[model samples]
Target: MARLQLRNLEKDYGGFKAVHGINLDVADGEFMVLVGPSGCAKSTTLRMIAGLERVTGGEIRIGDSLVNDKAPGERGIAMVFQNYALYPHMKVRKNLSFGLRLKRRPAEEIEQATRDVSNILEIGDYLERLPKQLSGGQAQRVAVGRALIKKPQVFLFDEPLSNLDAKLRASMRVRITDLHKQLKADGLQSTVVYVTHDQTEAMTMGDRICVMKEGRIMQVADPVTLYNRPANAFVAGFIGSPEMNLIDADLSGSTLSIGSQSLALGPAMLERLNPKAASALTFGVRPQHFSLVGAGEDNALEGRVSHVEFMGHEVYLYVNVEGQQMIVVVSATAYDRSKIQGDIVRLQPSQETAHLFDRKTGENVSLADLH
Candidate 1:
């Protein structure tokens, strides 16, 4: 196992900066995930650590050793790519033992290693089969098994499961996580760095998730913390399945004006805001935070139902508030569309779940002191 550290790491292509100065520390034996949309520089960051891309500035270290000057093979790291990259003519056994063969390891040693990995991955039955003869999931296992044979200190995965179907992808996510646990049980210290565009993958498999946007790191935290207490509006909108609803509002002392409606700020929330510093703000509320309420209830907003999605046990309501669109989620058992009056509904946001952000900076004003 190895501890990885990036000190003001940067990458530039002529005049274009692909990665900005960023710093991160990954503990030994940790499973860290880098996730973001395309063009966000997550893959570039992973390549830099693997020695596939040169750093424009700052240092890259692995286990107290500077690796910026080292070749990929000399850095004690193994990588699995999105395409699997297995040889077409090579059988499963040959693909897994290819690296060791190149190093001229003994015949018996190679046989033993191949047997162990194949058994662990449950692919022993197909060792003699070529890559073309295997299914997508089986081929992926061979690719991962090839990397495992190297026994490197760090494992890097670059969207290794993106090629599979939804069901295969879900199963592979669990398989990879279990593989990590198996490695630990076998007393092999293994550190992993995974990159993906899927937020679900990051939330489910990572020990900690790093969210990036453009060329900069946005936020890094455990899944629950990232969801509940986002550092900024971008994170609040990015981490959840149904994105958080952000509405423009004007703040004056303890009163918040959303369109033509007003909500009195609770004392705890009022203490967190500086009225003189911010007049215009963005009020954020997640879909699950809004609940159905009586039309005359305090802090309730009246809206017409634009659309409704019946999702088995839960229902999502798309509401048009004035000119803005907002989404609300409710239990299907508690809400029935046919009983509504004039297709109009009253939704109220729980005061304790409200999030306030600075309109100009996009920073979460409520969490100013926490960061």
Candidate 2:
């Protein structure tokens, strides 16, 4: 049982702290993703777990072992890098078996392991090809095969799919998730810690995702929980495609004054608000949560269409609400093409899914009652 745990894990680069004291746990056979924008200390945290970066404070436990002082190879972890770090001079087979060869395993054992991994990754045909002869996707497969060949207690991936194109990245995402399931079914220790800045990757690939900001962890949860019930304004904005619309407003007696328009927050929505909520708030609603309604509708925000994007199945309507820009996604078939720029529209936000954040703290004041 190789359950990974970090207790107050920290990394201090000289005087500047890169990773604050953060605690996390990755259950055995679980795929955990660390995701955030650049400079969020996610990669630093992954390196520390792989023993490449020194932990300034706290403990890192892999099952029964405390491996903060161990070398990278001694941590029973295999890492796949973004660059597909296969040995340039060696063929795919040789690259896959290098670690086993270094440990002086018998030739038969190394060859069998390489063959097994190559088949699993579907790189058997490229066994004799050098790294330079392979395409980006093929090279990435060799990198994953190399890690799989190790059968380590934990697997670490550092933006492994970022180098590939959009289409390839999508395919590889499915491949990696399928591989994790395959390993788990085979009773292998498949604990995975994957790091990426892409929220889409985190959402689709991880069993649970850990979101970090600066040197602090923002939130850790499954994709559904993070999307439908974000803990704060940051997670609500960061995890979505076009991002959640966060606009400043004044909440007075179950009514929200957004710019020049006033919205009556119905009693059901009012009951869901935190009792300690303040008057000043950052109203949060996703673009998809907004419905295009008739003009002069009650409890709706008035806006004028500024721009529109005609996606195949849906239309992205960009509107200027007062001075702030807001986006509403409507089905292409339902959108009237006659309503072009400068057209007035009303957007009704779904009260069940709307969020209210404290203006000063950026904390979701309506979150407690949501649960």
Candidate 3:
């Protein structure tokens, strides 16, 4: 568990920069996850930490040592790749002990390390089997066991569960979380940085998640902060399931209108608006925040439901209102299916929960004055 610091880090091939100058810190024993869409340079960042990719510029520090010039072996880091990267020819125990054997470690120590890792991973019974005979999850455990045998300072995982089936991936996620905790309890100085494009893994696994787009970080926050208070429109739209509903509207001196229809927020919410914002703005609301409110001036908007989807425990309904679309999630037991699609209804959002952003800048302006 080592503290890592990356300052003004960059990766370039000739004139093209794959990764811009990025700064980040990984606390000792912290589980940090880097997540982004394809071509966002998250995998590049993780590989740079593993010494698999050269740092075009900036310093890479593990604990107090600047390791920019160190080779992968010299940096004392073990990387678990997406493919599991196991040796098909070797038995599980042999694969697990390969690194130690390559380093010419003593027989007794190697045996003890292999035994301990297998026990920790609960793969002790499969040690004699070859990789070909093992299940996907078992093979992955062997891959992790290989890394553990080296007992390196840092662990880098790049979409390690991407190859597994849905059920296996879910199970492996829990195992990996438990494995991190188990490692920390042993007082090892290991820093972990996992890279994934999957939102569920990033949300469940990371102590801090760095959301990236176009090789730049949009926001780096814990899951709770991200879900409740997004930093920008992209982050808000990208981070949530089904995303937040964004609607264009008119903003006057003291009133907000969705075209001819007017809606209102609490005084506290209104006070946060830009004093000069009399032109227009965008209002955002999460699906779960919307509810039916009686029609009235400056209260709600009328909408005709277009579709409703039943997702077992809840309902997702799409409503078209005021030339815009809104998604609402309702309790399964409360919302009747028969009146879902054709009903003409008025919908309102809680005053405090509504998020308002500047139309041009897309910055959060709803609660700016209150803060």
Q: Which candidate is the best by TM-score?
A: 2
With a 3 Å backbone cut-off (N, CA, C), the pairs that clash in candidate 1 are: none
C-alpha lDDT score of every prediction, in listed order = 0.90, 0.91, 0.84
TM-score of each candidate structure, all chains considered together: 0.96, 0.97, 0.92
- TM-score comparison, 1 vs 2, better candidate: 2
Window of ten residues with lowest summed lDDT in model 3: 334-343
lDDT of 1 by residue, 225-256 (tens): 99988888888988888989998888887888
- Residue 177 CA displacement from its true place in model 3, Å: 0.9
**Colliding residue pairs in candidate 2:** none
Q: Residue 355 deviation, candidate 1, in Å?
A: 1.0
Q: Write the per-residue lDDT of candidate 3 for residues 1-371, one digit (tens) a residue.
A: 38988998999979989888898988999989999888999999988888889999998999889999899998878999998899898999899999999999999999999999999999999999999999999999999889988988889899999999999999999999889998899897557899998888988998899988776788888998877777766677777788899889877766778867887656967766656553667888898887765444247778888887999888887988888999988888867544433488667776677777778876677656334
Deviation in Å, model 1, residue 2 alpha carbon = 0.5
Global fold similarity of model 2 (TM-score)? 0.97
Of 1 and 3, the candidate ranking higher by lDDT: 1
lDDT order of candidates, top first: 2, 1, 3
